[model samples]
Target chain A: GAGVSQTPSNKVTEKGKYVELRCDPISGHTALYWYRQSLGQGPEFLIYFQGTGAADDSGLPNDRFFAVRPEGSVSTLKIQRTERGDSAVYLCASSPDRVNEQFFGPGTRLTVL
Target chain B: AQSVTQLDSHVSVSEGTPVLLRCNYSSSYSPSLFWYVQHPNKGLQLLLKYTSAATLVKGINGFEAEFKKSETSFHLTKPSAHMSDAAEYFCVVRLERGGNQFYFGTGTSLTVIP
Candidate 1:
């Protein structure tokens, strides 16, 4: 079975640019989540969606970060005016439902230079 | 507030020896705990999770964790260490404080020696 997957395993962009990272959750999964991992640290939650609507977006650091999942299976994490602090491995995860363990993706490493 | 702490930043164990990784948590609500492992340059994999079920939870790769609400601890353990077990371990706690979110620890790097 296919696991959660993120595209462009690696992305390098300049500061003050805009970027979008995509995630394809496992088929039939209604729960999708996004997280960010910095060097020598664990992943921090970013956003989560159940079905077509976002169930939670509190983890998003600021207004510059936004995500949407209109179809409930594919989600995108968008960053505007990227900063050096935005450089991190963006991880996506999905589960059968809420309150269950989640499976993760290979993640997209974004580097700002 | 909800938070998790990996007491040790790193743990070195000889192959075939016992492995123990300590974790403690604090949450205003009843928290759901999880253990995830990440190999170098790889994505995080679920090792085990402790929800509102049995306190002792067993997971893949012969790993298990016991949740103790009294102490607010969920320590992961394996009877014997394997060379492939070398990786970074993260303790996570989930809560619905206002909205659903997961809090992760700094992570504990496990080094298995032969």
Candidate 2:
């Protein structure tokens, strides 16, 4: 892809439901990141991946949240037992390398009812 | 650990007027500073960055920022504000020697009056 791309730009799900958000990074990028943004707040780091391995998952809020980049390209963020507080924009970004500048996607607005 | 503080939540300026948005950062080591802008319903756009190259860094749309180590500030400035400049701005800080993570400030909203 020319830029980072996210699927399902808007997602509406009920509480306790499971949801999966996808991210397609630019071609040949080796680093991917996920973030969450609440209203009136800046994006908060969720997780980071280097190639197919998760280098930093410390930012994941809890056990309910998990992300995987199976082939060092596309990534998926899985949320289990979603709660209303999970309503926010989920953003994805990618960089050529772990230390380079990141390019962001349009983001998916997740709304949990 | 690194954090950014955007001093002003909102700032308004008339067209052709000078613009200023204040930001302060805290980091354990020398920091990589950045400014990103977000238009309504859009992704973030990097405005400028200070990666220890020069204290005065210029960016797109005639915007620029000066990194002041003594003041611990990286303030965005524009000599002439345009209506198109109205948007939300964020200040970000990254640790020079860390896990390559970036910390962002809450953000500052800029209103340009015609």
Candidate 3:
């Protein structure tokens, strides 16, 4: 079976530009999560989705960051006016249910030039 | 608040020798603990998890961990180190309450030398 997958493994953009990262969770996985991993540090939670709604967005750094999971499967993380601080590996994970072991994706490395 | 601490930033071991990675955690409630490994340019792979069922939990690749409520520790260990075991390991603690938030440690990089 296919695990969680993310598109555009690498993305490079200007600091002031906007970018969107995509995540495809495992089949039938109702819960999804997003995390950011900086160099030499563990991953930090960003956002989480349960079905079509954003269950928890408290981990998002600021208002410029937003995420959507319209269909309850695919999710998109949108960052407006990207800054150098936003450069990191964006990781996505999915679980069959809440509070269970999650399956992670390879991650999309975003670099702000 | 829930937090996790990995005692060692890096560990080096010779092949065929024992390997140990220490981790300690603090949480208000009964939390779930997990260990994950990440190779360079790869996603995190779950090594094992403790869900309050058993104190000793075994995971893939001959890895195991003992969950100690008294000491608030869940350290990963293996009987023998292999070259393939060299990678970065992360200790995670998840709070079941408040949307089940997850906290990760700084991570420990393991180096297995032959």
| Candidate topping lDDT | 3
The segments of candidate 3 whose C-alpha lies over 4 angstroms from its true place after superposition are none
Compared with the true structure, the alpha-carbon lDDT of candidate 1 equals 0.93
- TM-score (chain B) for model 1? 0.97
Cα error, residue B73 of model 3, in Å, equals 0.2
Clashing residue pairs, backbone N/CA/C < 3 A, model 3:
none
Worst 10 residues of 3 chain A by lDDT: A95-104
Candidate 3 residue-wise lDDT, A1-113, digit = tens: 99999988999999999999999999999999999999999999998899999998999999999999999999999999999999999999999998789899999999999
lDDT of 1 by residue, A42-107 (tens): 998999899989999988999999999988899999999999999999999998998788999999
> How far off is residue B114 in model 2, in Å?
0.7
Best by TM-score: 3
| DockQ each | 0.86, 0.69, 0.86
**Range of the 10 consecutive residues with the lowest summed lDDT in candidate 1 chain B:** B94-103
Residue range B72-101, candidate 3, lDDT tens digits: 999999999999999999999998776756
Clashing pairs in 1: none
Of the true interface contacts, each candidate retains a share of 0.92, 0.42, 0.79
Q: What is the TM-score of each candidate against the true structure?
A: 0.97, 0.97, 0.98
CAPRI class of candidate 2: medium
Per-residue accuracy of model 2 over A9-97 as CA lDDT, tens digit each: 99999999999999999999999999999999998989989999998887899999999998889999999999999999999999898
